[model samples]
Target: MMRREATGEAAPRTPQAGAGPVPAPLVASAVLGGAALLVWPAVFNGYPLVFSDTGGFLHQTLGPLMLWDKPWIYGPLLHAFHWRVTLWAPLAAQALLVSHLLWLAQRALRGTAAPAAHLGLCAALAAASTAPFTVALLMPDLFAPAILLALFLLGPAREAMTGPEAWYLGTVATLGIAAHLAHLPLALALACMAFLLGLPRGRALRDGARTAAPLLAAIVLLLATNWAGHGRPALSPHGATFMLARLQADGPAAAVIRARCPEAGWYLCAFADRLPMDANDFLWASDSPVNRDAEGRARFLGGALIAPEAQAIVAATIAEHPLAVATAVLRNALRQLVTAGIGDTLGDDHLRTALRPRIAEGFPARERAAYDAARQPRGVLREAMMPLAPLHGAALLLSLPLLAAGGLRAWRAGDAVALTFLAMVLAGALANAVATGGLSGVFPRYQARIAWLLPAAAILLLMPRRRS
Candidate 1:
């Protein structure tokens, strides 16, 4: 039996090293990938097939195809094929993207066999663990990991790039923009990293421009496509209006307060008992009488407050209640790391029950009543699982310490790759916490995206260094 080499340690070079048998890391990654593909579907069989807001994404993409002849819906190229083939499109895209990301990781870890192994293991675990939440979702969260992984791979390449690499980076940045606007931050972070890493001033500027240009172009393409297809851009008015309204409400102080208070519901304050509220909530409630009337509705929209008014509120809060705001932000960041009791599993159950009586009085009366009665028992399952939810929560809680240790070890070792990995993870978590205003009704599934970073970083730090 062949012994597997320990991670990050270099394998001995052979006379036929360039043409030797396939690397061990690649083989392990393949096995891990295969296992993920096999087991994920079964584990999450009863989970909802439709993700929250998947309908919105489908509407954005497919709605255009139904209405006009535009080349794309939101990006430079329309995922027209993807729109038509709904059932398999999202899954297929995820698989291909993940495979590409893993290959890129392999390339990034070329010299350090140990780091490569660690990254491979991280990829495998991420694939398996996150699949239940990410795999079948129609939203952009699934695509975020692939973009982040690509950024991780490209971090080291910044130092050694020629013209072609710049173009490649530009293309990736374009894709990142098209995939999700949230990912634009990662692209910006990379450009900042290029400058900080001491690439020649001229080359750094050139490379940065090259990478950013495509993203800009993609944005333009997105706008133009929307303008040509729909009378106006599909995203502009709605997104802008929602953001503006959020800003006008409680401001950033409200956002800060929301972040600190983890008990606030996702879109309402009713689901979780421990949710927090402050002056911001008062201000928000005051401004949006409609939201106040609806009660639980506005809480979900809290994420939109990241714009100007919210920023001003946050700034003022920092100035006035600096200590309090800082404490809240930190606390929220911590809460975001754990798989706490967030989301509307119970709320969903109650809503389902209430709707049953209404369905009995409405049309399609027999079928609707039967469906409701059948699902009532599943609500019992949902309740039963409520007690066991803490077990999953504990697992997430345990991983954080290990991740912190890994992060510290990586930082102390002066490993740029490790540092970048940690930075990306922290940035993502911070962004989510600050932007979303705490974890309140956040679903456990969302944590799947960045959860593997801690273990991956730890593995890299623990892997033995190869002889130079």
Candidate 2:
């Protein structure tokens, strides 16, 4: 047992050893409630949620070789449940993760919230925020918020946790951090930001390192997994390329390429005239000469040729065009902060182009029918829910001030629990914007994926007190 600032007595850590199992009726209620929130996207989509990268993840499921574009560990987990084409297996697993996250949030607050209140908050998030969107979405996007929640459990709840609870938080932190490559940096940034912004002043730096322990473990896990799966004991090798694409988006990479290309022996020099303005199109679009040509690919091989050159260009360009670089990064981060990038994400037809052949050989026939009916390439689909995006945007905007106010209030009241919630959510959102937008490029999916945390934390702080 451990004491908090508000409660001098040791708090309940876990259930007593002799306590009976959770009530069946309570379990049923949770399932029913969870189903209500988790099924909204599937119901609306006419099938399970699918993103553009979902098929790539599906294709990489236990692939013979490792792919750095997507982290290695996530694919195997996705592959494990590929026996069903309906994807119910994976979706259920993800919903369970979300449930555990919500449970942790309530627990981190020392059971301040009642079950109904928790469910109500969940419903609000699903209806008016990005919570269900990422949960139902097939990508590892949900892990961003999951990591922050796990950090809360590890940080503020550090002393009070039972052995099993500690292990659970540690595991969640590791998986949530490792599941997505971008999350690795996001977790590191959040751990530091929370320690500085939320933790008590005594030995703050030391405590910050302790707060980041799980993230370190996750980094090691990713390296080990990549070694076992990809033959390289390292994080994703795509950082340099990602950085390159980012420079392209800002107009500096092109200048560097043109200035030093044929003379300096850089490969991108040949395609200097044809580079696309968009980072994504430059990297992934088939028509772009970068993807179409051999030299472009060769330049990026092991970052041996292109990575160093990209670094040099970025440095020199930053030296010459510091304002431009900062302006681009800030603009992209702001773009991610406000507008949700739904259109550029989410897969419907092109997924089938990559998925149908694979599933035909292995997927169950019944699932194939559902997949065809719901996901196969079609001529024209209806418009997006025009109101939902802005409604979510507005909800997020409202949460910004609420979190700010909550943080100040918590510090004044000496509420470590409340401060932890605020720190994790706010730091996660800011780090997400910087890492996802600044490192890669500003994409809607990046912001929308983690935007739910702000509102979730605000609701947790502002909810009416439950009856004792």
Candidate 3:
């Protein structure tokens, strides 16, 4: 093992002939223990956590309706694991995968894969970060951080991974990207960083393309699934509608509607008086300008029906007020970066009415009963998670200086792996904020899902370095 010291120099490389391969049983036990820690929130909750969008994803395969805003990938993923018998299967799978990735990262950063060290890292993150909560959730939110870790492994820590491990990470990255629309842009940004960071070392083209391979694969999967399900090769069938909702919430689209109303004659023009609303209201509220009908009944299809008009409105708004649009997007992204909280992830009061019926339809009696009795539905998980907010905030705040110091130290020591890992983490945070916050509305869950990585990176950076 080649150890890096405080000074900008490598200590003598030592051979470890006696340090043989770790026993398979020990590795399995460590990973299972880590997985348990990662999903502790779910275990404590008595059921896997779900969200309003979980129903939409479930319908991808379990129900007849094909959701316009959602892709078909994650729904089938849930069905594959749970077989409609238990939601716990998918949650456990996600936790195991996340735990394995964390273990791999720890090994790459610390140069050892001791079970105690791996479990300790997992325990610390479980205790202090939102990672356990994110893992427990049945939503694709867990994949956000999983994608970041996968990219870091495949990019900065590439040399440390075995051939099979690299393949597995790439597969994880591909699935993570396909799980949610926001992940595509996040993955692309990280891949671009991988290429740019490799330039000085003359591996720019290879590293960039390698890192981008999963993104390309995810795109193909998305297109194939969309076409199979909706006869559309588009990545997201009604993606423009979501963007329009976001733009309307931000005020630019409303301005366009108001200025062009009664003449430009888009459906939105009729609601120019109700110009701007919260993005969620614009998309989901029964009386929203977008979803309300002449009789005041909810017309959910209005969103899909207005998709073409939404695209036109979005284009016109961006063209007419480019500066306003840019400023609003920047503001939203900044807000998204800081609004990391576990509240939305646990709070199901608003979603219960709509989400419960889907749970009943999709799951067996036992599972449905569990869903109804879950802490989220009973309004206990939110209270249980309240104490974690300050701790998570403090962890994120402390990570700032620690990450900066770690990056500075790595730079001075010429630790390319450490430098690249830190850069990737920072870039991932920005990319995720821009992708989710700018495209969708600013939501705490969007940022909260990935916030754990900040502290994880700080801890990984502080780990003692070893040769790849």
State which candidate has the highest lDDT: 3
Name the regions of candidate 2 deviating beyond 4 angstroms: 1-28, 84-86, 110-113, 197-207, 294-324, 346-349, 375-384, 465-468
Q: How accurate locally is residue 428 in candidate 1, as Cα lDDT from 0 to 100?
A: 54
Worst 10 residues of 2 by lDDT: 11-20
- Local distance difference test, per candidate? 0.43, 0.67, 0.82
Ranking by lDDT: 3, 2, 1
Q: Over the full model, what C-alpha lDDT does candidate 1 score relative to the true structure? A: 0.43
lDDT per residue for candidate 1 within 272-390, as digits (tens), equals: 23223333343345434223434434433433433333344345455766565455555654665564332333224434433333333332544344434442224443444345444
Candidate 3 error regions (>4 Å) = 1-20, 295-300
Choose 2 or 3, whichever is better by TM-score: 3
Best by TM-score: 3
Q: Alpha carbon lDDT of residue 52, candidate 3?
A: 79
Candidate 1 TM-score, C-alpha based: 0.57
Per-prediction TM-score: 0.57, 0.86, 0.94
Candidate 2 per-residue lDDT over residues 1-468, each given as its tens digit: 244655432333443211113354664466457646855766676666775567667667523446557676666677676654557677777877776567556645544334576577778888898777777777788788888877776765554455676678788778778888789878888778767754343435644665698889888988887688766787765456667778777887777777777887766677787653788876666655445555444323343334555666677777877787788788877777665645444445466666665555556888767767763233222245444777878898898888787666656655655666676677678888877887787777788888887888887776652211
RMSD for each of the candidates = 10.0, 3.9, 3.0
